[model samples]
Target chain A: MHGECCFESEVLAAVVECRWPERVESELRVHASGCAICADVALLAVALREDREVLKSIAAPPESGRVWWMAQLRARREAEKAASRPITAAQVFGAAATAWFAGACFGASSDWFRSEFVRLASGAESAGIGVFLTSGVGLLLLLAAVSIIILVPAAVWLAVGKD
Target chain B: MFRDATLRDAIAAALAPADSESGSLVESQDVRADFAMDEDSFRSFYDRTARGLWAYLARVTGDRQAADDLLQDAFYRFLRAGTEYESEAHRRNSLYRIATNLARDARRRSVVRPDAVVSGEDIERVAGADSAGSLDLNADVERAMSRLRPNERAMLWLAYAEGEPHVEIADRLGLKVGSLKPLLFRARRKLAGLLRGKDSDHAR
Candidate 1:
């Protein structure tokens, strides 16, 4: 196997440092030139090390401060979103509850609603949609309840966007 | 350990009822309160590792733009991880590991293997002042490297470019040392063959 050898590391070091076959001792240089494994190591190591040096020399990563502040900004946004989640949930819950309660109150106060609901419950061929349309206050309250159901989530969506 | 002390505190405050997974892209806020490295420490670490990490990413992915994006992502994820490290080397390993996985995922997500934009102009342009045949050598390297598997490129680069040993390479690449030797050997041989083939083509 061209994989294991005691001198592979030394040859690799000399090559990486640009010392192989010249700056290093003649004995090692001769060995590296002669041994297949050492020769392969020298070839690849020097090429890669040179490439690495060129890359580092030419490449300029963004300044550390910029990266830091960007991270901080992102973390803050994440935190704000996290904080708003429960609040949003509570808002939706509250809106739904209020809509339900207002509908219940409107139904309890309206004689027309009681008569129509009981008629439907008794499986009677009761008055159709036009009857509820005529029950003015109850109709208004039901419309308001439906509006709240539709608008609250729309408001939350508008406020939060799509995350 | 954070000198600022505000980041995690803010996260903790916000995430009080935090396990709310509803439509959340950031999987869990369970560890939101625990970033161990402070801003100063993070800044210092970024300064130390960014260049090297960028080079590693650029070479492995063959996309400098992807490398740039992934580099920032790696640092952010590292900070967000809130992991406490035992040593500087450990921290580096963790960062590199995160970077490696991100690059891997990015590659898998990419519909096609990204073209090797690591051109001769980048490498030989620097060594242009130095030895003879530097142009041909660098071009050959870039060409040969593009042909290897990403893991192979990573192993060889870590070994030669970063001068990391087999054990550390294995750890960073998520391979056991026992399995790494053969794989590294095979990769190195493939690389040598490609380089040799290039030489022969020129000779012909």
Candidate 2:
């Protein structure tokens, strides 16, 4: 029984590691001839290992692969048309300009800056330096707006028409 | 676990076929089934697995944003795939494999792009406050996982965390089971070494 128990201990290690083979089973049978305890331990260990695996199997959650794959497929589908459409220099330029315009608009509309602009405009009539600076800024703004209204559309048309 | 029968029934009901005059569209039904996953299942699954997937992807790409995108992408794919498994274990193994592939593909497509949006500090902060297990252990695991090659990490995590059998893992990974034993041993040794390093660093 002692010898059989020792043999079962050895088999238990192999079984835990999932390395059990036919030879190990045959060897176990030979050892079990003398040791019933060893035989019982061997059987118990196998059952325990099987139970452990079953519990592990049960505890595991579902795979998210199909979900991940679906996302990949969806991304591919969404990207397909856009990917086929070449990114043009005009698109880059337009994006940059749009960003700049938006930033400028945000800056202009900000309360802090709007208050400062009002203060400067109000003080311009009283201060000679303010008057010249304000009018100079006003004229520049008008010129810029007019230039953008004309040249901007023309450039956009040129860029678009090129393609 | 049985006490959660109500939630399971909810999921089952959500997965149940809808009656229609037109021939039932399995494809559409499958897509809608995710909604039936109940808040509990979705939250539990996301909480338990999403972070692991994210951490794994971040380690692979060394980018937090990329990991986040991939994580979301992975979940979205899972929702759309209509994959059915006989058991949750099979489902999880499949999910990890898919996530690994997605991360690999993303890495291949853009080497220069940032893969993860969140910084390591942010991840640590979130993990630290988490009540699940010790943050240190999770951190160590993440650092250890970071050191492995993509496939090695995937194999180890699936084996250790998911406790999948070699055959199931091999099937999921499209590898022969015979080829996995030695590879798994080596990967585990490497991960153990990495984890030890993390522990040592933390100790200091």
Q: Which pairs clash in model 1? A: none
**Residues forming the 10-long window of minimal summed lDDT in candidate 2 chain A:** A51-60
Scored by lDDT, model 2 comes in at 0.53
- The reply for model 1, stretches above 4 Å from the true place, is A88-135, A138-142, A145-149, A152-161, B1-35, B111-113, B119-128, B131-135, B200-204
Model 1 chain B: worst 10 consecutive residues (lDDT sum): B22-31
DockQ of each: 0.26, 0.02
Q: Give the poorly placed runs of model 2, Cα more than 4 Å off.
A: A1-163, B1-49, B111-144, B197-204
- lDDT tens string, model 2, B1-204? 233455446544543443242133234334345442434555566656665566555555656567657777667666555666666676666667777778888878884264323334443334223322344444445455556777786666555544456787787677898788677657655665565454533211
Candidate 1, CAPRI quality class derived from DockQ: acceptable
Candidate 1 chain A: worst-modelled 10 consecutive residues by lDDT = A116-125
